[model samples]
Target: MRVLVTGGAGFIGSAVVRHLVNDKRFDVLSIDKLTYAGTLTSMVSVNDNPLYRFENADVCDKTAITQAMSDFRPDRIMHLAAESHVDRSITGAKDFVETNVLGTFNMLECARAYWQSLDSRAKETFRFLHISTDEVYGSLGKEGLFTESTPYDPSSPYSATKAASDHLAKAWERTYGLPVVISNCSNNYGPFHFPEKLIPLMIINAMEGKSLPVYGSGSNIRDWLFVEDHAKALDLIAERGRVGETYNVGGRNEQRNIDVVNRICTLMDEFRPEHGPHSRLIKCVEDRPGHDARYAIDATKLEQELCWKAVENFDTGIEKTVKWYLENEWWWSPLRQRYKGERLGLLPSGA
Candidate 1:
């Protein structure tokens, strides 16, 4: 099947592209804006593959997205493009609103028009898979997992915009009869992850013997999912998931913020014994504004309905992730020059 993947050069998007091109050997057209986070080098593995093609276009561009949809004539449209960093979103939300909200609105409208133009068989087979996040469900207390039906109570501009996009996707399906399936996933980490996020940030800082900043008391919890596993789940949802339904994909592995950092440190120490005891670099810092206390996804619906299972738990995934950074400096070295481990999301002193 032919698939058009928006944001196909970013971390999770690249993973999906690699999986579809290498594993499924699907004809894939990757459309990305090449934002600071969306680097084409991430998809170097399959960039030259016969089945893979890429276009440097922002999803927010109605003409570009509409043209790509018309040109690719894909069986499935996987929408993964957005401004995804929480810390970055806190500092500048306009970009998030523009890309996540407006971009998604455009994607939905374009896809609806394209679907309408297709013949009966093509329309029936086409799927618009909207990738989303668990953060839209807001902060969870110490108890309970976020189900597919959880009411949205977004804590940050990032989540708020993503929630708006999710609503737009569902409304398109309901109002316009667009065949859309939504997947809200937990935190994704693995190879090709940008250095700004938690896992890679800690790993790189510890490697440089820099302080590993832990926000607040580092008690906030998050459910972690391997990026490759998420890529597979996305493919499954696109292929067989029911239209207008929501699926929550997670690794079912929960860890506190401090614990996750310490784990990365431990793995780093094992891999680079010369830089032993990396945990000593840990330092507490003020938390970001409206930091969510916890987030955990209940993926029972996805598992039972789609027969999906995560291959990597936290321990296995972290080990592979640390080793990837150590061995594949070729991919991340340039990114480090562009984005060092400086703190973000800091409000002005008076604010």
Candidate 2:
């Protein structure tokens, strides 16, 4: 089967593309905007594979995307293109709204036009999977997990735009009979991850003996999913999930921000104890505005309905992630040159 993936050069998107090409042995086309977060090296595994093709294009440009989709004529369209970094979205919300909100609108419109042109059987088989974040449900209290039925109460510009995009995908399904399946997942950490996010940032920073910055009291909690496990879940949802249904995918591994950092520091100490304890590098900083206290997902729907489960717990996953970074400096060094783990999303005093 042929599949088209948006943001295929990105962290999670690259995992999905590689899984499709190398694991499932499917012909794939990855359409990505090649943003600062998107590195071509992520796709090196599939670069020379005959089953894979890539188009350097943005989902915001509906005309170009529509043409690319038409040329690809895919059996499935996995919409993953979005400005996903919450800190970057705080001050840089324009890109988030434009890409996540407006861009989703364009993809829905294009998919509607494309789905209507196919024959009856092809229409029946076609699927458009909208991958999203559980952050759209906002912060959880000390208890409870985000379920598919959870109401969206976004706290950041990033989550707001993602919530908007989620609504748009559902609206298309309800209003136009478009076959749409949505998957909301927890934070993903694994190989080929860009260096900006918390896990990788901490890993690299500890390796360099740089102070590890933890926001506020460092008590914020998040359920972390290994990216490859998420890739497998996405594939299942795209192929077998019911249309107009929302599935929650999570690793069932919830960890506090500080604990996650300390774990990494311990790993670093083990790997290179000559540098002293990495915990000394932990430094609490001003927290990002609208920082959610916690985010966890209940993947019962996905687990029971689709017979899917995450393979890696946070401990196993984090170790693998640290090892991957240790071995793959060639992948992340250039990224570190571009972004030196600077603080982001800080509001000016009395703005």
Candidate 3:
């Protein structure tokens, strides 16, 4: 299979590309603009492989995207390119809309055009998978999980753009008869994660003896999904999933933000005893604007229909993530230099 993955250099995108090339041995083309959070080095594991290639391109540029689609002639397109950080979006909503909303619109048009040119069998077999976040469902109370049928009530600029893109994807399928499948996933943590995210930031900060910032007393909750498992779910959803359906993929692991930081501290204490009790570095800070109280996904549809199961829970997945950062400084050192641990998402009064 020839699969074209946009944003293939970013955290979750890179995971999908690596699985496609190294495990499935599919001919994969990764198109990325090398944005601040994306680095080609994330795909080093499969870059030299015969089945893998990359193009430096932007999905927001419809002409470039259409040209690449024409050239690659991919059987499957996994649209993952987006400005995905909620905190970043609070300060910079325009970029999120341009990248997530406009980019997805352009990608859908490009995919539809390409699908039209394909022969009957090729068109029937083609798939466009739109990967999104569970944040689109907004905050959950302490009771229920976010099922596939939950109405979207996005609370942040980042998730609002993603919600718009999700709607566009389904509209393309319904209006233009394009074959599209969507997967909204929970928080992902594993290797090659960007340092700005909660998990990696804590790991790297604890390593360097910097303060591990926990926002809003750390009571906010998130369901964690191992990135590799989410990648596998994407593959299955694209391969055999019914078109015009949305699947929720989650690791079934929920943790309070403070507990997550404390767990990381405990892990650091085990791995780097010389650091001597990392929990002392925990520092609670101002909460983000419109921070969701909780997010938990009910992936029963994906689990029952697609038989997808996450292999890593919070305890195991977090241990693996911490170890990866501990062992792979070569991969993260340059990123740390560029990001300097400055806090993000500071909003002024009277919006």
lDDT of 2: 0.90
136-249 in candidate 1: lDDT tens per residue? 999999899999989999989899999999999999999999999999999999999987778887887888898888888888889999999999999999999999999999
CA deviation > 4 Å runs, candidate 2: 341-351
Kindly state the number of residue pairs that clash in model 1: 0
CA displacement after TM-score superposition, residue 344 of candidate 3 (Å): 1.8
Please give, for residues 1-351, the per-residue lDDT of candidate 2 as tens digits.
999999999999999999999999999999999988898899898999999999999998978988988999999999998888888887779999999999999999999999999999999999999999998999899999999999999999999999999999999999999999999999999998878788888888888888788888789888889999999999999999999999999988888898998999999888889996999999988877888999889999999999999988888889999999998999999987775445451111100
Which residue pairs collide in model 3, if any?
none
**Candidate 1 stretches greater than 4 Å from native:** 341-351
Q: List the residue pairs that clash in candidate 1.
A: none
